[model samples]
Target: MLDKKRIDCFTCRHFYITWDRDFRKGCRAMGFKCNEMPSIVVYQNSGVECLRYEPKLPRKQK
Candidate 1:
């Protein structure tokens, strides 16, 4: 069983903000938008943690 509690969609590479009234959040890897975090939506419908989650790389300092 996957522990979905520690999953933070904000730190994921695929996470995005849509600016939509209804669906404000989105995932590029899974290709879906939602009012809440995309990971929650995926887990709720699929009954499993998001498998496509990839941590965003840190930006290099100038």
Candidate 2:
């Protein structure tokens, strides 16, 4: 059995929630906004995992 890695846009630093009512999510790295999560959209269009996935940094508490 092959192990599959989960690709979540929420985990990426480039991922961001949008204010647009039509497109709710976006990827800064990819330079496009979409209605669905960027990771899923990219995978569906490209048939591969996101190449620009960068782990989101932990928020600093003041």
Candidate 3:
């Protein structure tokens, strides 16, 4: 089940925050924004979990 290992958009590289209040959340890979997490939006629209999930790289501590 998708719920077993949830795809967290916050940890994904493609995840982003948009200026639009209605669609503040976004996915770069999918090129879309939404109120909820991008993964949830993808699942809602496509009836399948997001396939473009890539884990975000750790930022260097400068």
Candidate 4:
């Protein structure tokens, strides 16, 4: 048996495609593409260096 899980769109930083309206607009405004999925992976207990640990942006308050 295998355990599988569906990826979450919100959790993914690169889930948005280039053709997506949001990504298109954002890219134009920022002059770059936004990451579409969660690129960082923190270890459960390992105290090792991680190259993919990108800090998440603060959530906007509305």
- Predicted model with the maximum lDDT: 3
Best by TM-score: 1
lDDT of 4 by residue, 1-62 (tens): 11234233344332334665654322221234444432211122233332333334678999
RMSD of each: 2.2, 2.8, 1.6, 9.6
Model 1 lDDT-worst window of ten: 1-10
lDDT of 1 by residue, 1-62 (tens): 34636579999999999978899999999988999888888888988888999999999999
- The TM-score ranking, best first, is 1, 3, 2, 4
User: lDDT scores for all predictions?
Assistant: 0.88, 0.87, 0.88, 0.34
For model 4, where is the 10-residue window of minimal lDDT? Answer: 37-46
lDDT for model 3, on a 0 to 1 scale? 0.88
lDDT of 2: 0.87
Q: lDDT tens string, model 2, 34-57?
A: 997788788889888789999999
Ranking by lDDT: 3, 1, 2, 4
Model 2 TM-score relative to the real fold: 0.85
True lDDT of residue 51, candidate 2: 93
Error of model 4, residue 31, in angstroms: 28
Instruction: Give the TM-scores of the predictions, in the order they appear.
Output: 0.87, 0.85, 0.87, 0.24
